[model samples]
Target: MLVTGASRGVGRAVAAAFAARGDRVAIHHRDSAGLAASLRASLPGQGHAVVRADLADADAVAAMVDEAAAALGGLDVLVNNAGQAYPHPITEVSYREWQELWARTLAVNLTGPANVTWCAVRHMLARPPGSPPARVINVGSRGAYRGEPGQPAYGAAKAGLHAMGQSLAVALAPHGISVASVAPGYVQEDETNASYKVPRGPDHAAQSPFHRVARPEEIAAAILWLADPAAEWASGTVLDLNGASHLR
Candidate 1:
């Protein structure tokens, strides 16, 4: 399994979960050498490999996927979890800034995954019949549908990912491959705690029935379940991991 952006947050948790389940894990990190080392030390399997790649660079992205596939002998799963979020008021956002934000977000959250998925699909199709199908689980955000006021680019990128996952599911089904997206709500991470803090007030607690933000591991659990071999029938489904905060 190849887990991009596995150095920290939900990606790290997902990698750990798979490793705990006795699956070989290829951890992809951009620059977090310390975090990568920590993950290597923590993972149970001897097949754990750490890969570094600047996901924004096309060549690097391709190399990352290829290297991971090689390390794992064959790619069985891909978890696209690398993403960026930049919040700017519409009036204050400049064209250049918007372009940079959109490009970066789209590259990592959309195009990068699409590229990896295409490569994995080709590998799956070439495999012998009756083999377990490969799985692609995209880590999306609730903002894809909820419309974050200050982060339109992030929302748009995630929405594109959802569409891409659904399309790929249809395109790869005949080849016995599965593609799905996991859209998580406000995940309770250190960064979110520092920057996008939801006040611990009565009104805030009442905003959702769950009364708290999602833990990183909770989201990882959803990804794990979706990536399970038995979940082949659930392909193309955008499983919402939100706490029913914005139920429509």
Candidate 2:
């Protein structure tokens, strides 16, 4: 299994869960070498590898995927959990800044995953005869449906990601590769993401009836379920993990 952005936060949790399941994990991070290495060392299993690549760079993404596949022997699952969100409200930023934010956010949150999936599927297609269908699980955001007023690009990219997963799900079914995505809302921030998070307060918790935000582990659990062999029938489905915060 390979989990992008596995250095921390939800990605870290996903990687840990898979590792605990006795799977060898490839942890991918853009620049967080220290964190990625730490995660690889702390994981429960051996053979875990740490890989780095700038997702926005297509060549780098291909190389990274190949490296991971070689290191882990092969890839049975891919978790596209890497993403970026920049708060650039239309009214608050200059036109140049707006363009910059859109390009950067889309590159990392949408195009990057698309490229990564392309590379991974190549590996999946080569699996031995009778192997179980491979799984591709993308970590999307509820903002795709609920709206990201302060970060329109992030919302748009996530919406695109969801659509892409559905399209690939259908396209890859015949090849025995399942593609699905999870859309989560307001997950509790970890140390690595504290600066980008909304301050924890009653107002923040009130976003859901549960009066709280999601834990990384909770999101990981859903992702784990989606990657199960039994979930092959669930390809193209976008599972919502928002705790009833935003119904569509």
Candidate 3:
């Protein structure tokens, strides 16, 4: 299994979840060498490998996937969790910033994973069908549907990823591969900690059906479940882990 952005946040949790299940993991990080080292040491298995590459670079992405596959002996799962967001109102956003935002976000959130999936699917198709099929679990955002006012690029990229995952699920089904997207809402990470401090009046807790923001582990469990072999027949599924927050 290859987990991009494994240094922190939801990616870190997902990596730990897979490790707990005895899966050999390839932890991909971008400049978080210290955090990556700590996570690699924390994993239960000895085969866990740490990979570093700029996901926005196509060559680097392809090379990273190839190297990770070699290190893991074969590719079984891919969790595309690396992402970037620039929250700025359209009026204040510059042309250069907009281009940079879209380029970086789409590269990591969409194209990088698509390239990795292409490589994984090719590898899976070459092997005999009886073995466990390769799984690609894309980490998306509820912002894709709810629409973050200031982060248009992030929302658009993630929306594209959701569509891509749905289409790939059907396209890869015949080859015994499964693809799914997990769209999470208000994940309680450092990035969202400030938002939590703001009071939403009396009905704030009741706004979301779940009554609170999601813990990273909760989202990790969803990813793990979707990647399970038992979900082999489940394809083109977008498991919205939003707790019905968007309903209101």
Candidate 4:
């Protein structure tokens, strides 16, 4: 199994959950070597690996996937949880910043995952006959449908990611690959944290009738379920883990 952006936040939780399940996970991080190393060491099971790659770089994404497949003895699951965001409110940012952020955000959040999934699918296809079906779960956001006025690029990228997951679910079904995505809302990096500790904490909490935002582990658990073999029927679906914050 490979979980990108596993060094922190929701990605971190996902990696931990999988590792605890006795699966050898390849933890991917862009520049968080220290955090990634610590996470790999903290995982309960053995045979876990640490992989680094800047998702924006196509070559790096390819190499990283290959390394993970080799180290883990082939990929049974792939979690695309890496993302980049720049709060460039169109009215507040310069045109140059707008263009740069748009490009960077889309590259990391959309195109990069597509490339990584493609590489992983290739490795998955090589598995011996009669093997269990492979799973590819994408970590998307409720902002894709609710909108991110402060970061339009991020919203657009996530929307594209969801669409891509659906497309791949259809395309890969014949090959025994199931694809799905989770759209989470206002997830705190830590599961135990009760507050955002920022000015908008109350506002974010109020978004959900539950009076709180999502915990990383909550999102991780949904991801874990989607990766289960029984979840094959969920392919092409985007499960909402947003606590009803943004109903669609």
Per-candidate Cα lDDT values, in order, are 0.82, 0.93, 0.82, 0.91
Q: Give the clashing pairs for model 2.
A: none
**lDDT leader:** 2
Tens-digit per-residue lDDT, 211-242, candidate 4: 99888889999999999889899999999998
TM-score of each: 0.91, 0.97, 0.90, 0.96
46, model 3: CA deviation in Å?
A: 1.6
Please give the distance, in angstroms, between residue 245's alpha carbon in candidate 2 and its true position after superposition. 0.5
How many residue pairs clash per model? 0, 0, 0, 0
Worst 10-residue lDDT window for candidate 2 reads 192-201
- Residue 41 displacement in candidate 3 (angstroms): 0.2
Instruction: Give the per-residue lDDT of model 2 (tens digit) for 1-248.
Output: 99999998899999999999888999999988988988888999689999999999999999999999999888889999999899999999999999999999999999999999999999999989887669999999999999999999999999999999999999999998999999999888787667755656777689899999899999999999999999989999999999899998
lDDT value for model 4: 0.91
Ranked by lDDT from best down, the candidates are 2, 4, 3, 1
Assess candidate 3 and give its TM-score to the true structure: 0.90
- Candidate 3 C-alpha lDDT tens digits along 110-146: 8877887786676667665566768989999888988
The order by descending TM-score is 2, 4, 1, 3
Query: How does model 4 score by TM-score?
Result: 0.96
